[model samples]
Target: MYSRSIMAVSSWNDNGQKQFVHDPYELYRSDFFPGLGWMLARSTWDELSPKWPKAYWDDWLRLKENHKGRQFIRPEVCRTYNFGELGSSLGQFFRQYLEPIKLNDVQVDWKSKDLSYLQEDKYAQHFANIVAKAKPVSGVNVLQETNNIDGDVRIKYRDQSDFEYIAGQFGIFQEWKDGVPRTAYKGVVVFRYPSTRARRVFLVGPESLKLLRITDS
Candidate 1:
């Protein structure tokens, strides 16, 4: 649906294919493109709500009117724009504050047969103890060990999830080496989207080889 408030400009792509460009003065207001308008609208609302009083609604409308249709929407340029940051931030805010009311009424199955045996296992107790004692810093989630390569174990977390970390943050992994219990600081790596395959490489440190439990050929 074309908005009466905004102007649409049709242009040709690299293959000389005709495309309609929706130019909304605000990057967030352009609905001609998918998901762009929604992101901008939400972000702008969040940023403006606290500052703008109820009396400022007319001003908001005027701002939209003046900027609409004059802006250019270039599809090629849009590809380079970062939407992950906005999407992740909005998702986190919604999940924390506005999760569905139905979710509150749903009952959790605490006595499931799958988890019944976990209560009786000493190994589970040890694992739980380890988890309880482990303090997670901002970026580090889990530290695991692998023998596949010099920098095998990855420090996994979505950067856009309000959890921020540098590339070289050290994580300590507790595992068995030569039949002896050992703990070593392995390398850290962030997770990226579109490549959700297992064993995704993030960061490999020089010391990662020294911390390996098994020697790689």
Candidate 2:
């Protein structure tokens, strides 16, 4: 089962992951699985049916499944969005985030694609390789240095506020949930760089790379 790509919603050409430019429809592993739309197998549903939580089912389901050593796949460009602004959170970040989320208009041929690489172990290994190869950039004005880099670059953020500020500089999604930025994998958020460039930008947390468990080879 997979999430229908809720967070980090944007057009295929606008805010998609730069690394997957040739296959923008490619799915990646996610920390939170579902919110707007998702799929569930009947067998899996039966296993979780009796133990459903009464509140925050989405969050609970994600944690529940995740605790079972399960991995969920989500699209870089979200397929669904949360428009109910009058909910419990009371329109918080509605304008700053939700309102700016662009619905994908392009049709993807999902049936024709080979998505086997999205399996838990394969995706984790592939994503880890990408993160390992990213050039770490550091400076008082780190964003400026990215302009001189030839390939993907990684910038570290100290905390939530720092992440928001960095995200603003790059104009990517700024929201975070459970210590993860939008579209993050192991606490690293990735997107195309400079708006005019196709190079990738990796916004990483202090210990994010370690979580990938990369080893010397």
Candidate 3:
């Protein structure tokens, strides 16, 4: 169960809207609340059970303070795939979004992995350095050079519109929740691109670096 707890928030679209997206195989930490196949400690359950929402418990959990300062391990590729094609939303996004998710097939020894770096304090610093060191690329034209780049790259987006435009180009998730994209860490979304290499692309918000101290003087 401990290893399974490391699973990503695969389904349960909160907005009830369709926005096609896809993910790759990688691991990162973020605040995206898990919808299904999640584990909870008995003690933690004791604390939250009293305040459980009568309806939309998942949306309630999306609130920051509810899971604030808590480190959640989510994978770039979802651990579980949702097969329900009919629901309240009437399968609106099923064909475009949910239907295409590639379930993780790699058997990883999660128990042996060092997850200490994923802790709040440690991950913040570690991720900040990664974003800072990433080669900066601007405009969709420049993105064509990624095939030749040697390391991780970062693309800065001025706003939600810009983010959607850039995300559309790379064919990744573009929806935002509370001003943050899915699988985001510190206002940046991480995903491996081109589907054939190990290099990752970081779609960073304008204020992300400042918030992460990557731009602090």
Candidate 4:
């Protein structure tokens, strides 16, 4: 549910509420923030892994122990990154990596920036320095996008036994890879669970859907 490991900055709203945004493309896509020029550097097992594992958590605990007094969440908006606390380097990142787009408000999880693509290059160490100073809490946000809305497309897991087709529910198509079948792409999920044949499910379809990924009480 989470995205790949990437360096990020904390951005804030006028009301003092804060959120972490790490995607350079998304930063440029919105109008409220600036962009920076930085490339992600990857050289770790967690970075390569599809999901964070126990080993990753173990390392994160060690990092937390090393910086016991350090505060990951800023008391106030960062001066250089305050628009809304969107950073000064936002423009640089936008120009370098994204198309002409405004850095807008977006969602991000900042719990794993300890060793993101921090090393930009050999000449400039400012970004690297900033990244080094930023110590995210030890954790991982499993969900990429949590917004749920009617008519929004999402991914859901289904089973082989049930073949019910509900209107308004966009059925996801999967193809076999290496003789194994799989979903074509990934996106947000309207249904809490998943289905084999995805359909554009309506909020009020005639039939009630029992999500597959539910926990039993």
Candidate 5:
């Protein structure tokens, strides 16, 4: 069993109550909170290492800098600050609003799991396994909003889903073209090896494209 703790603002009432969200920098969205019963239940309590908070803080700070109009915690949020100051402010905010949660005994996986696989052979084998067992991808679409008669307007597809993903599987359709899903392919050939293009940093779950190496050649 894995043990984890989340901070709640209030104590348990006569009504059944439980863990609360522990985000300090996040803007409260009333509309989003009411329907999170499914998501809250399924969240895995990872043995998320200590470095995660530092990594997250750096990313969060950078993201906040990109969008200055949305800072609700700091009054002089426009002013730039160091990591120490930001962290201090976060601690203060946490003390004000949150109470430490009590929980039943949980088994802790203290062994450090190294996620950074730097070896080339490991990566190659990983991709190979994914491609070997991947679901067949179908229904790719390419839409040209502006027509150019002079030359072929170069179009690129981002690594995203066209339709709702089912069981960690997605598709690049053949017949689903001209901005619509269709029944069958129109003279399309899929690939055996995964494309090196459209790369993204993967620190978590397996990428959808890695499994389905089927790209237009």
Candidate 6:
């Protein structure tokens, strides 16, 4: 049978207002009480463990051996710290179980408000180095085609006689804008060649070539 001690009593008065009456022993058991039960348990452990003679070690070992699953009171509740003994005990328990896990190994890609990654010179330099290392194979023939209806420029190149470029490969385009030449980046090809034209296109605004700055590549 489980015994429940009435730690507190709340009553509704004639006007329907509630009032609370607390028992001293129950208050000691409560988180609001100071220097009792759980609070006493944790504090006593801390104090006695230091001053306790070496002779107590045998009894401590025996207690651990006997009461493996038993729950003990904590000092937080008995001390009336507002948070209560259970919170403190829970914190200790979680720490004991979780401390061995390595938090650094967890990979979290968080979207941050800070744009510091854009300003970092090392990241920029690393990207620049990667771009510098990439070398397109030379001596390969490239065919240029223009589409007036869609206002796009297309480039067709061959790996073999009948094959088109890979679906995801990017194409860089140089075109004229306002009588000056400008370079623009384009999206990857969506379809491979032989089914459709293996051509990659850039749909820059019309009249872009009026500003073309023609220079030898």
TM-score of each: 0.18, 0.71, 0.77, 0.16, 0.20, 0.18
**C-alpha-based local distance difference test score of model 5:** 0.22
Per-residue lDDT, model 5, residue 13, is 13
Candidate 4's C-alpha runs over 4 A off are: 1-158, 161-169, 176-181, 184-214
Error of 6 at 134 (Å): 1.4
The digit string of per-residue lDDT tens for model 5 on 38-152 reads: 1211232132222235443323322323222111111100111223434534674333222222221333232453322313324334433433433332233222121112221
Off by over 4 Å in 3: 1-26, 88-92, 140-150, 215-217
Q: Can you give the lDDT of residue 63 in candidate 2?
A: 51
Give Cα distance to truth, residue 180, candidate 2, Å.
4.6
Residue-wise C-alpha lDDT for candidate 4, range 75-101, written one tens digit per residue? 122122323224443674434322222
Off by over 4 Å in 2: 1-23, 62-66, 86-92, 147-150, 158-182, 194-196, 211-217
Best by TM-score: 3
Write down the RMSD of all candidates, one decimal each: 21.7, 5.3, 4.9, 19.0, 20.2, 32.5
Quality of model 6 by C-alpha lDDT? 0.23
Residues 1-217 of candidate 6 have per-residue lDDT tens digits of 1112211111111000011111111111111111111222344356446645565342342232322322221110011222333554367533432222111222223243332322323323432332233222222332222322222233323322112232123221122222211111111111112213322232222221222221112
**Model 1 ranges with Cα > 4 A deviation:** 1-185, 190-193, 196-199
- The digit string of per-residue lDDT tens for model 1 on 125-201 reads 43233222323322333323322233223333333221123322222112222211111113222222112222223
Question: What is the C-alpha lDDT profile of model 3 across 49-167, one tens digit per residue?
Answer: 89988998766666676665453566666666777888743465766566766666677776777777775557778888878888888755656866568788888888989988887
**Each model's lDDT:** 0.27, 0.63, 0.65, 0.24, 0.22, 0.23
Best by lDDT: 3
The alpha-carbon lDDT assigned to residue 132 of candidate 3 equals: 83
Candidate 6, which segments miss by more than 4 Å at Cα?
1-115, 140-217
Candidate 6 root-mean-square deviation in Å:
32.5
Clashing pairs in 3: none
Model 5: number of clashes? 7
